[model samples]
Target: MGKLREVEILLNQTQKVRFERAMERLQSLSSTTNNSVIVADSIPFNHDEAFLKGHGTSLVDGELLTTVCGVVNHVDKLVYVRTLRARYKPEVGDIVLLRYSFVAQRQSRWRVDLNSTQDGLLKLSSMNMPDAVQKRNTSVDELNMRNILAEDDVVCAQVGESQRDGSLLARSNKYGKLHKGQLLKVDPYLVRRSNLHFHFIESLGIDLILVRNGFIWVGEHTQSNDPMVVDDEIISSKTRQSILRIGNAIRVLSTLGFTLTLAVIMETFDLSNMENVQIHDMLGSEFHVWSQRGKLKEEHVHSKKNVKALI
Candidate 1:
């Protein structure tokens, strides 16, 4: 109550009418809700918190309002607002990778690919750089459209503010770059915009690039102890199926929101499935079928005959 600079009971005609109706209802329910009574004319119609404080009391009008959380003594104090909040609050500000196709020196703006709708723009002047820093980078020749960034090149960036009239902005040269790795894309709808900061991979080689549209990765794969890799690549294909299949399996698990454990399962399944299949039988079948087959197709029979004559 002491927080009030002053108190008033003033009310407009409409509020007076509303107050009357509310008071009538309050007569019966106020005992249970424990709200203070409203004086008809002398007290006026006090809507602000200064005149009313609900320590253990309810308001007659509180029931009538839909959106307001009950009225309080500290209404105007701005207590609930939080500072240092992350920019993208699920509605916006998902970390996005972009490429700058155009940078305008005159307006000091960048034309960036946002992966949806039209491209986004980041203005140099709005980067909030200090004058001293600006002078230091002055030799950089402002910013040419193509010199700083060209088509097809990728950049790691953060989502910035959007205009009410429909424009998007992003920034993040200070954050980090999209280094060498494989690209992984998840369905855009599956990713909560707020979840962008939560992505992490324990492996040194694997990194996730999350965006609203999708994510791209750039990395060499680690070897998995899958027997499928040994049989498919080493014995049959003679390639590093272990690492490649592990990478693919990791990708599928990532799409399903499963973490690294799937990599182990993929390896285990490869070994388990390979034990039952006889590689000798497969090779024998292939040899018999291939050996008995004709060397040439119907169209190639004439060429085969010419070669036979030459031999």
Candidate 2:
């Protein structure tokens, strides 16, 4: 309460009223689920009943309990907790955005941060080398290893089979270092897995990568990076604004606990343009109050339709 006051002015009377009502409506629509629980809470399931414990659950003195803070969810006999806010736990084949940690000199593997419990070991032999890095020679020397993946470079890769050494693979041709982008971190739960991760907004000239770990990348759309060409692509002001606009929309949506999909993101981006809101003003309290009313209503309806689908 004290901290929020220092950041900005509170909402005015009318905006406050509207915002409160919208919050009520939003909560009411989602109130059906009573399974959200926290750590050390005893689940109200019969101890005698045959039940299989899954992730986020533990047996404490023969009593089933949650080991983490998340919602309790079950699929038939298998019960697990769906974490709302937690450090990323990498799964098999998950497309994750990574930050370069360092190159392991002796092991000949690049260590990358996955926002997980352990840093992933990426073997030099496993990944298809990026075009941007000109190898000094075939040997994995310290100088050339730095040239391949410099310190603090952002990378996009896939989680491989969890090895004894926690090896992460980047075998796909498309998986490589990401450039010309803005990375936005949000709650991992808000981002659902999509059929395709890379998308191009033809109208805005922006490429949106929906990473599974909740690091959304919005950048200028480019098919390939040319090693020979100089890295001096000057983006027009309009395209730059489009990138910022889309990036802010993702931030605002995620802040509001809105389910982030490509469709809803475009809607939010388009709404800001339609209303003539400046890029900087998108994060203002007034804009937040104004945007949620209509968007929440639309999402509520869409969720219901999805629930009705038989197939």
Candidate 3:
């Protein structure tokens, strides 16, 4: 952590404040040190004591250290990690937004980059037809798959059952072909997994999809429809500003390494409005520091309350 501070010194005003915010976030996540797994932190096991090392652990100078941060398990003789939030360990029903590339003209499925070890598979059969019928995919569908979603298409879909080749699953067009939105990427760890990933904020006319893979989409709200028909509706000035403001909110939160949640994001947005900070100036050093430092105080107070409850 000292290295972080040293690096912060090298950054300019805005960059320094951003680092401070990220540092604050790291501290906030570390509130529960007993369970919070930090990489390279020593395990409880004794160096002399004989015990089998497991996943996320490495032996350095005869001491076991965790490589990944997650739940620790000691069963019988072997030990391992659990509930790992370090990476996008794909699960069934996870909402994901991925940019896909069609490998070849004859390929029936496009390999999607889901920010995982192995690329996700989106088959032609999983896509919704123009008429919305669930039928067996044909050669014609295979031939026209690129038309529905050509190379470099950003798709918002759900994870289905895993395939035989150990690739993450794909689903229908319930959340398909995201268009006219700003896609922001962050560490998957910062994106907390939630049962409801799609959030449409009526007040701001914004559609917020928090994909488990840390790809956030903030755009003008639109109903899910057939992917065949392109909706090229022009966004009004007011709505465009709303979209950009929400996108900036996301950027600030991500820059601070804060967990991106709907409530917190809205809170930040509301706070900015209350402070009368301009949309473009939210990224200024003053606002970033104030935002994160304020958030840190809240987390501290919340943690203290939890501790008092335990007493």
Q: Kindly give the number of clashing pairs for every candidate.
A: 12, 0, 0
lDDT of 2 by residue, 77-154 (tens): 889987666667788888888788988765578888776667877777665565545354356454466777778777
Question: Which ranges of candidate 1 are over 4 A from the true structure?
Answer: 1-91, 104-107, 125-140, 143-147, 164-176, 182-186, 196-200, 218-311
Model 2 ranges off by over 4 Å: 1-35, 38-42, 45-69, 73-82, 105-107, 131-137, 140-142, 225-231, 296-311
Residues 49-136, candidate 3, lDDT per residue (tens digit)?
Answer: 6788778888888767777656567887777665334567778767788887664443777788778766777767666566777788
Candidate 1 residue 160 C-alpha distance from true site, Å? 1.8
In order of TM-score, best first, we have: 3, 2, 1
Candidate 1 displacement at residue 154 in angstroms: 2.0
Which structure is stronger by TM-score: 1 or 2? 2
TM-score of each: 0.37, 0.71, 0.75
Which predicted model would earn the best TM-score? 3
Models ranked on lDDT: 2, 3, 1
Clashing pairs in 2: none
Task: Report lDDT per candidate.
Answer: 0.37, 0.70, 0.68
